[model samples]
Target chain A: MFFRVVLGMVLAVASCGAMAALQIEITGGINQGQAIAVLPFEQPAEVKVDVAAVVDADLMRSGKFSPLPRSGMPTGMAKDEELLKADAEVAVTGRVYKEGGAYQVEYRIVALKGADRGKLLGHFKGAAPLDLMRQAAHRVSDRVYETLTGQKGCFRTRIAYILRRDGAPFPYQLMTADYDGYNETAVLKSTQPLMTPSWSPDGRRLVYVSFEGRRPAIFVHDIFTRQRTRLASYPGLNSSPSWSPDGSKIAMTLSKDGQPDIYYYDLGSKQLVRVTQNQAIDTEPTWSADSRSLYFTSERGGKAQIYRHDFATGKNERVTYQGKMNLSARSIPGSNAIIVITQQNGYRVARMDVDGSIYMLTTSSLDESPSVAPNGSMVIYATVYNGRKGLAIVSADGRFKANLPSSSGEISSPTWGPALDK
Target chain B: MMLMAVAAAMSIAGCSTTSGSGAGAEGYDGQGVVTGIDSDGAMTVGDPNEVQTYNGPESLREKNTIYFNFDSDQILDAYVGTMQSHAQFLRNNPDAKIVIEGHTDERGTPEYNIALGERRARSVARYMQNLGVDVGQLSIVSYGEEKPADPTHSEAAWSKNRRAVINY
Candidate 1:
């Protein structure tokens, strides 16, 4: 449960003032990735947010590059040979200026004289409002990532998480912000509790459990329209709503039957088809990448562990055995691995292969509710720090970790939405 | 006649009406509060114009909350008397309603903790029904770890958080 102090956050009529976005601090990381140097961008005085710093931090946080620090940066701008001499594989230099009251940045990434010598990966240009310099920087980072790795970049995506504001009327707020935890806007606020926000594939709507009417119910919130539809309000538990890959149906945990089990609620007909029927607790239903099967956490074996339910074959099998308890699992897109909260000496986020091999991905003792980024490069989980719950992100390989601190109240159940169209 | 009798009894006791059962019978629209028990350990719900009382053990008022061990929903023997008092009160007042809010500490996964919390609340609801409380009179809600009675993460806070609170 969250910190249940009375925070008066009435949503129906009360307006919410914007609060400071979460400040992301990389808590732990390894400097072993490919070396890269980002020169301090020459910028107009109107652009306040550091675009180069944002790009540098993005590459560093991905655990894929070792960006040279400000001290290691060359005076003015370094040439391709100087970057090679500095042991850097790539150099990024940029210039920012103002055009028609908007800020514009032009940057170039060049590979050093090594594997791909003097390769101008791309010449990129980005523009935004003077205050939205971070978005412009993130666009540049996405282009750089795609150019280097040949994979789509998630830098331009948004993440939605539950923020428990510590005031009276409406304490729980569903917030969506940039992937770096800036430009936060409240999606919904209520005096009651909200949990487990899952984004639709298009990132246009979110499904989450809310207790606005003093009961646990699943709601689908349209991100743009602010319209909500109550999808499930069974007599008992109607929690853990996850959209299918096709967005045609939602697999959720419902206790309207005998026990809490995974049930698929079709959006068109609104018919519920039970997926699991054991007396044990079968909850936290997440769809596989292909939407052919579901991975859920069940206590049917007497301990909380992950089990897979195939929709086509009706086969149910345990997928995790390396931990005493494993729950809150999500299938990492574009891979055969699924990230889960596995308990070893303590609960930590781990990557479990479909064949039963497990790779621990976090160092925190009390990590839970892991959500893999749409690109499957990073996982976000909630951890307790200084007696308060905060959001933390770790590279899928467990090499780099970052923390996003929300001083308002406890943050929980973060879901990384799909990559947006920039 | 019944309203006058209940109001006279409330006046005699001079009880505070905070966290009490609502005003029952005769359309008396007044807020009721449950206060300290009488010398005989009877629980009383006092309204501005009426009072309803239930006979129970001295600890019944203090024992409305049933605490549970970690990941358990079994009711202990010590709280049986308190629950019986609650069941008897419901039987005496069929119009009275109650909500059992099940909660858990911040230990297990949230979805499972939600099921665990519901099991705890349902356990209380079933026990009260077996003691003659109608099923229609009682409803259950599981807060899981989402609403901790105590915010600390220590054992003290956890023990307090894992509980079924009987709300009238």
Candidate 2:
């Protein structure tokens, strides 16, 4: 499908030598985030920063809700009737006050569905230092996500993406930001490409495939200790590293044995176990929560589609039937649904239930890499937006939307960080 | 001539090895040079028809590589004609094959580029396959930026290095 598009692209590129980036990239979870509205936290106090806007973005990045912009509000947010009438499932109300060089925030969320029945699902109140307002908002969204999906929310989760600066010898820099694209910090930088970033289940360490040694190898970097170790460099292909849910093993692709296949490496035992015995392309492997099976895309089925290989029976069965081309498959945190790149009409992220039925999330041109939030309520993967390495978030059902166009550079292979409980 | 023959044979075989200790040449650099010359592209030395061998005369043939921009896996038009020639060669010589090795300029994430490079090579591989080249003779390897065309640490040099090499 990508090849077919290439021909059309030739004509398109020839017509407009400058084919601007027109896609957005979002990576999160797949509860199919809710589109709740947050009326700009009434910032009566002179706190130059817009905390509510940050929180709104935080919620959007989780791929949950398409927050209604305050500018588009037909009326003021103070009236509960207007807030409820906004048609958004939920509405946020908050007020900030200065207390002796500190800021106090009190917020509440109303469920529009229960308004007619005189029942309110959310009544949250918290007050902390001004700097922690973002964290406070995340906590609120975490509650909103949980209330809506019955599962936990990934608002408190982190995301790791790469940023390439213009002049740096190794423009590729690894950075971690909150789920809402805030609090970005560059973790690693080099002129060489740093890639395939993954998070440990505990959220304390990050493992990525880096070429610092002139060959692709898996590296586990401890966030607290700031120490990193090379996990594997399997002679040929050593990339696409995904951690086991238990944090004991890493499922990756290696061609050292000849032909691309799935392999699992035990962290403690330092032993390598071969998983998929395939001669076709079998890379990008993700483990089921139970860690009993591995999900990947293989062309043995005539074309690349999602398939499952059980560890016990070792039987590999094709799971995706909707489209011929499906490359990226990320299992929703606690659900049987897997979000993947399906090529039905074009390259876009689609979700399939346990049995393998495609549900296209983005109606855009190119959407790759689907990552779910810790809650499975939101899916945040990377896609191009207007020629930049932008991010997009879509609700599980593929309705809510928001675009986070990075002002920096191209961004890809985004891995949703687990809940930041630590 | 014998050393050249060995290099040529390796290229003719289209063996893109991640490690070079098998080359037997003491000073072999992992840059794919093996010894003194680049074994890719137009120039042909040993038997071009030979298909397989560790170090045969076919290795001396220059490999056709398509360079890419930073962090991009999209195949450019500049490489289309080259891929067409590659397609023609593989089609003419049914026994002959090509392994598209994707490489990225050292500017993004290595894992992403590994995937990016894989996407690049696979793009070409899939394109060639779509053009009627048999998939069996075609294999792909994404070195990410592990193997660069130019070892020097410069933007211009890195741009040239981020390329997919066609071997065989």
Candidate 3:
């Protein structure tokens, strides 16, 4: 009942800022999701970030929970009876307060009905500077989501993407932001183009393709230190740099030898090992969870398709045969499924199981560059929105969908970073 | 006089546009001269026997960019004369270095588009090499769909975007 009403008000109010942050627009979700109430956190006028709203949006984006609107929420700290009356299965209440020139946020997830009625499921408190209030709020969401869903929440994780602002001094920017599209910071800016950013497993650095000198070169950039090391600047096209799961090597597509083929650069030894020997276009190499094999898109099969290259056996096998073209395959964490851009009706994001069954996730025609969340619960991709390119998110089940439209220029090649250490 | 007559006949044959496949040596009329305007009304003609010297970008008649079909990297027959003109210019002036920049329409994955763009550029570079352009004069880069000649999302714009630009 709450979700039915909330569906009418799906678009969240856009927050005002100097740099317009990505506004979350929930398009669809499953109707059977657990109904939860996230009350507005009690905070002083000086504190700007809404901790409860962030948590609510995070849960809603997960597609496992339907957050009740504030209109349905009872006034002033709803009790268990009030929550039950509002059809909320669970209630998240929180407060943000200042302490010693810093901001601290405290939140509690309370069960409303069932055997665990009136029981506190989770209580989390985090502190950060005023500027990092959104991050602190995301941590609260992470804890609350994990406690409720029994799975690690990706709210605390960040997303790395390329934002191209035409005519700017540095048109292309490597950006990092909270999963909710807040706290966007440019990690690297370039006059030429930057694309295909792959996050290191440690979430501290990013390996991406930058055309800084009017040529495609792979660079490993430390997100915090702002130090850049050119990994591959081979003669021809050098692009599609994917960090291995173990963080020891980076698999990329290089044309120095001949056509674009998969090659892994060992960070420790600085040796480039060829993965696929095909003359066809072999690119977009994504390491498996174990880092023992690579899942890459190759045209060796006559058309672009997903292929698994086992490093130990030196064997290559085609993984996808259903789509007209399947490109940019990324292994989903904790599962045998991989998210990729498949061309069926048009280029759309889809999840392919180990058995080779394809499940379309997004309905957009021009969707590309699908990056699965660390938890594999959602996918972020680049798509055309109203003729302008922007990023979007969809639940792995294709139930929930949200559009993250930037305030200005186009955004593409989004890669969700790994979960940060607690 | 015999070589000039043969070159003029080849340029006349290149103007036929009947061969839709990859153009062979007959498709290219060398000597930095592009004769006979194509259907696009975008070609320039110079004396086939003049032994045209490479002056600058103006010498190539501004025919540096070549487009491809959807999801294709094959050099169209229409662009063969343009490639021949560029090849002649590069061979005449080995000191002139050019960057063959590849691109694609805003479809498919960005990484794949990068590969496709490179394929387009490589196709152009190979075409020039076949026409005897020095390898040292050509370097290739792919912008994929990032730098579009036209940013519009329609088929016309994508045709313009799916191109390989010869930047001298």
Measured against the native two-chain assembly using Cα atoms, what DockQ does each of the candidate structures obtain, in the order listed?
0.12, 0.07, 0.17
Tens-digit lDDT track of model 1 for A1-422: 11112212122211222224345666665466778888888887766767778888888778787787756566434566665665578888887887786777888888885668888888877777776677888888888888888877789888888877543234566778777667666676554678888899899999999876568888897878655677888999988889998888899988888789999988889798898999988999998878899999999999889999987789999888988889988999899989988888777899988688889887678687888887888888888866778788888877778777664568888888888785
Q: Which pairs clash in the backbone of model 3? A: none
Residue lDDT tens for model 2, A114-206: 534224666666565666666766776677667765767667778887654433323456777776566665565543557778899988888
**What fraction of native interface contacts does model 1 preserve?**
0.18
Over 4 Å off, model 3? A1-21, A97-104, A125-129, B1-55
Cα shift from native, residue B28, model 3 (Å): 42
- What number of clashing residue pairs does each candidate have, in the order they appear? 15, 66, 0
Off by over 4 Å in 1: A1-21, A75-78, A99-102, B1-60
lDDT of 2: 0.64
**What lDDT score goes with residue A284 in model 3?**
89
lDDT of 3 by residue, A1-422 (tens): 12212333222324421125455666777455788888888787866776677777888888888788776454434565665665688888877777897777777788888898889887777787777777777787778778888889888888988887654434566778777677566665554678889998998989988765557778787877655677888888798899998999999988888888899999899899888777799988999889999999999879899999998898998899997988888888889999888998889999998888999987789998888898989899989887878889988878788888776778888889999877
Q: State each candidate's chain A TM-score.
A: 0.91, 0.82, 0.92
Q: What is every candidate's alpha-carbon RMSD to the true fold?
A: 10.3, 13.0, 12.4
Best by TM-score: 3
